[model samples]
Target: MDLFTESGILLLPRDTFLTDTHVQLLQKQRIWEVEVQQVLSEGTTENITNQLMDLDADKETVAAYVKALDKTRSLFDGIGRDDKPGLEQFSDVFYEVAEQSMKQLGLFRSLYVLEGSDSYTYRHSLNVGILCSLIARLLKWGEERIAFMGLAGFLHDLGKMRISKEVLLKPGRLTEEEFDQMKQHTVYGYEMIKQMEGGSELLALCALHHHERLDGSGYPHQLKGDEVPVECQVLAIADMFDAICSDRVYKDRTSPFEAAQLLWKEACNGKLNIEFVSHFVRYIALLYVGARAVLNSGEEVEVILIHQDEPMRPLVRRSGEFVDLRHERTLNIEKMIG
Candidate 1:
């Protein structure tokens, strides 16, 4: 076992036999556990079992995710047919499930690689809602504001419900005309929420502007920075992130780590808010420090350490030797397997 300090200093090298003096040395360093053969910690090494669940459903983690997803779809279907679902009612149900999903599990654990395309939009909505709450908490927003952030995220893609199955579920890339038509959902959603009796104007605005990029490159209104509300900015990051982490009909999914890298790149290119992206990237990287992942090369690797400067490029251990992803240009983390 290799012993390290609480601050990650190498106090005792690997292969050293455990002795009374070594135990005292570890105690002095305030180290609780050693990195056994450089394997990741319990939180990540036991990742398969760490999946967040909706305890109200009394099901397994995957089952709970499916349950919440189906509930969201049913609600959207109500909206599609002009049922005019109640905003407070919807928020109540959403808060119940989103809150349950976060129980015991740390933030951002909702970044799962979904297998099918049938439930993408609604699942994306819930994922974004959950992620928004996390981002709000990270930003030190108050409880009520954080709840509003989550509700905004849940309703941000509500406009997509008006889109037809043919266009929304197209197997490949959308035609230019189809893409333009798809973009109308943002506007459609804004009007839908605006007509609701108890809906907040901020929530309606978030629904409309969630697709608006910071550089005025986004569609519809072509909004730019400061023109975009901080609430919508949080929704934008969460929306883009869930979309990337999920498997779309036109493209395969990227790992949360890789997706974070993509979000960081977009932020760097001035498409996203840099302040939010930087904080979120580091938060994501830190969560997976002891996690297991599959690389693009089809090799299984264990994340060992997160680089402070370049968080996306973490040090991973495969088989035994350590590989610094920052130095390896070709191999990239494809997705988490455990």
Candidate 2:
């Protein structure tokens, strides 16, 4: 059996699975590896299990991460634009390695987001992976398929490495010429993934077809509905979700509710799969449960669980008016108050 340590290391055990409690204890102590002789010399399985089960979830780790994400966003803003090519290449390598590590750990969680980014492409790629994994889990996809989608999501923009920095970061509207160049990253990413070892054609297909739309109006190829693979369809939705939500030279980062509203509208307009859009919307809204938030009235509160039918508006208890955000169109979630 394979055992995972708290430090993110894995070891092969002679026999038996570690109890959930032992996992908790290791998680609590942050002592990933103990020379079995040193830590467990004569401890019984029941003893270890009891200790770990008593440990609480790591609040300190989560708080540290909130601070780290703020730092990472600032770091991305400062990275030299001239190093776009190098950063993009390194981003691909990083995600590829992250993909392998994810498979080994059986974790399809948001480590890619934690990995952070020094470039726009890398940041967007990691967001895609996080968003895609969220969608996959909501759809009840098996673990391997989820990981494959996560990897595909992470490298969906691998072709951007070939595009020029000036075109990518241009503050003004892209001229027709610059716009054409920007679109080539999809094809560029496909070719790179195709050449990589152990690459899936499905993943490369996501690279090629993520830009294609249901109305036959998207770039690279104008393939309409049913012509595109399901994987491609899913990736396309994930790509659009990440792109619209992030900050750009011309656009500020969109609020998650605003992004969700847009996704809902796009689904209605036939730009996304209705089922995929519905489930993905539900998935993302759930992740922010317990997050501190601001209402349009400027009141502060923590979000409770979402109402099952009306996910766009979660049930939140604030310090002021007991307004139900779902019913009150005027009051909305202002932002995540980190």
Candidate 3:
């Protein structure tokens, strides 16, 4: 049975899936069958819920998580308008949803591949949770610390909610005044999280220091690398990965391969952590294998994992020449395709 109905609501085995016709009827205010509340209140199928709890990384189940994220994004976008849906309430929903998604993603190699540009703010937060959890697992961090870092990723961008939509969605460079106001989002997000119930100072610091650079050049507070919390550093790297790969209204998206290259270059320049970049790149490269993508020449190809030293530039099979992307001077991954 399909997990989602035509109206894009979850449907358990006990409930029937709605067709597009049914949604049209509802839109026309027919209201006879499947009221809005009944549709939304439908719980996930028992099987799916079990898979989610067990952190299964099966393809179908992971797709369900992606669908759930899309649904939550719609719900979140409706918050804080004239209707005044409490921003805190909306943030809570994302936190809970992300916690669940992260657990499932953690069972896999890396959450970086699931990262995309379509839904930036919501998806970026979720990706951060996944990456942070993976890093925590790799470091053998205690359970409590892992949970705290996961929560920190969720709250990393809470400050953005306070920024005006005009500024947030602007397609070009910001004025000095607008840029200054945007910088305050970090502080705003930290204070907002601190005021919430069950809020941790550690998590708030993630929101605060996520933008800080190792060279003490970042905003709000120019904390040097040694001064920043280790947890914040992890989140900072994850945040940068997601931001560069995602297509913002103001900036074009970069491929994960290119982003990784730039991150490594930054580390070499002492602006980021070299060890962390190495580990993050290792995990991210695992996720790209067998994934279809475009080459610099705009040809479609499939990645073939090889050579641990150069994971980002994998051997690819395009036409027939097993092109070692790392060695090919002219070929590089342009973008990930279906």
Model 1's TM-score against the true structure: 0.80
Per-residue lDDT of 176-259 in model 1, one digit per residue for the tens?
999999999999889988988688789899999998999999878999999988898888899998898877778888888899
Stretches of candidate 2 off by over 4 Å are 1-118, 296-299
Ranking by TM-score: 1, 3, 2
**lDDT at residue 286 of model 3 (Cα atoms):** 71
Question: Alpha carbon lDDT of residue 23, candidate 1?
Answer: 81
- Maximum-lDDT candidate: 1
- lDDT per residue (tens digit) for residues 1-338 in model 2: 45666565664464433445766776776656644432211122232223223333243433232333333333332332222233344344444544443333212122211211124455566557656765776788998887677767776886775677778767789999999999998898787677765666787888888888877878798888898777777888888877665555676555466577788888788877889998887767776676666676788877787877878788877875355787878978765543
Model 1 spans > 4 angstroms off: 1-64, 106-111
Q: How many residue pairs clash per model?
A: 0, 1, 0
User: What is the lDDT, from 0 to 100, of the residue 139 in candidate 3?
Assistant: 71
Candidate 3 collision pairs: none
Query: What shift in Å separates residue 270 of candidate 3 from its native position after superposition?
Result: 1.2
Report the poorest 10 consecutive residues by lDDT, candidate 3: 36-45
What TM-score quantifies how close candidate 2 is to the native fold?
A: 0.66
Residue 40 accuracy (lDDT) in model 2: 17
